[model samples]
Target: MTSIKPGRAPSFLGGIGSAFAVIFGIFWTAMAFSITRHSPFGGVSIIFPLFGILFIIMGVVNAVYNFRQATQKNRYSVLDITDSETEPDPLNERFGPIIEGHVFETHQGDVEFEAHDDGTRDNRRPRFCPYCGDDLGEDFRFCPSCGKRLPE
Candidate 1:
């Protein structure tokens, strides 16, 4: 829908999935809830709802994670890419090859996708550059982060 800024990570989805997990989980659990007291799992009578809530929380967490990833910032190219260039075909581009932002990935996947997202509250601030995990300094011109030159 929107252009992804190069050198950026997708938006951090915060507590978004929490809503979904709670909703669907509740729905499924709710069905069992009514039947529990009437059915087999009704010994305590409220356990069904308790589990439902847990599921809902799970769903919400899942959704938030997904959304966060989708919205996360992306590697920003130096030039503007028209829809025609990217839409018709990704490989075909008017601007010559451009360097995108850096990515700090792990075995699981990228944690600090963009250089700026590095923060204590947001992420653990991996020992390496947030974008590339490479060693760098505060004054380094290129991204010790990803070895890419910082935009002027």
Candidate 2:
């Protein structure tokens, strides 16, 4: 028993080549018939039609194989995010701790707000310094990493 391993779908080039082979096979068969009808040779003339038939058979077999391979579905199950029990976190799972910053203007002037990794923006102070990206544990007048003064 022969087991075939899973493979990718047939490429565009393969399909085009198969189609050309079938067309060429038909043309060859037609030409063979015309040649045999006009030729005076008896026994040897039979080989021409035999060769044409062989070409047609090979071309048809290749075309059918390519068609079947192209249409077969993948063996593995596709990943469906919606079917999962819990929703996946895009920012935390994919990006790994990304800080999205937004600025708003009020009567007091431009105010900067940092969006946490949980995708929430509640006017909380930025956890990391904007200049050096160092962790800001508490309110500070300056960034300890780059020694830059924080904006008042």
Candidate 3:
């Protein structure tokens, strides 16, 4: 099995590039506005401001996207695959003692036996109700949620 390693967050270089773009956009827009106000160029001057606005919008979007990525807890978009097949399942690792034929104790200090057993203490209960996709206990003769007869 292939194991995937967590990847690095969005680089600071990207943020720097975005900042440069926004600065250039602001400068370009200011220059365009000043030129249009003084010169007799008329409607043609509108194109410069529009291009500047486009650059500003693109830069802001890129910055915001990078900021969100940087703030995320799991920045694992880029995965490094490795040939490590012996990794344990996370669920099993968490509930190993309870799942290994041991009685589980509730928060209220009540111990509950495995519900899904066929008299020999082996957990043979169906995990889910096929009809409605609801979770099922081991002793269920029918789906409680969907009221469908379960397979024997």
lDDT of each structure?
Answer: 0.50, 0.60, 0.63
Q: Ranking under lDDT, best-scoring first?
A: 3, 2, 1
lDDT of prediction 2 = 0.60
> For model 2, what is the error of residue 152's alpha carbon versus the real structure, in angstroms, after optimal superposition?
67
Give the per-residue lDDT digits (tens) of candidate 2, residues 85-148. 1443454445433235453222232344656567777676656765557987677888888796
| Per-residue alpha-carbon lDDT of candidate 1 for residues 23-137, written as tens digits (9 for 90 to 100) | 6686878787766766654465686667887787667666666555556555333455333323343342333222243432333233434344333233333344433447765
For model 3, state the Cα shift of residue 5 in Å.
9.3
On residues 48-92, what C-alpha lDDT tens digit does candidate 3 reach at each position? 788889999999997776665566666535454321123434554
- Which residue pairs clash within candidate 3? 116-138
Query: Positional deviation of 33 in candidate 2, in angstroms?
Result: 1.5
Question: Which ten contiguous residues of candidate 2 have the minimum total lDDT?
Answer: 76-85
TM match of model 3 to true structure: 0.42
The TM-score values for the models, in the order shown, are 0.31, 0.40, 0.42
State residue 28's C-alpha deviation in candidate 3, in Å. Answer: 0.7
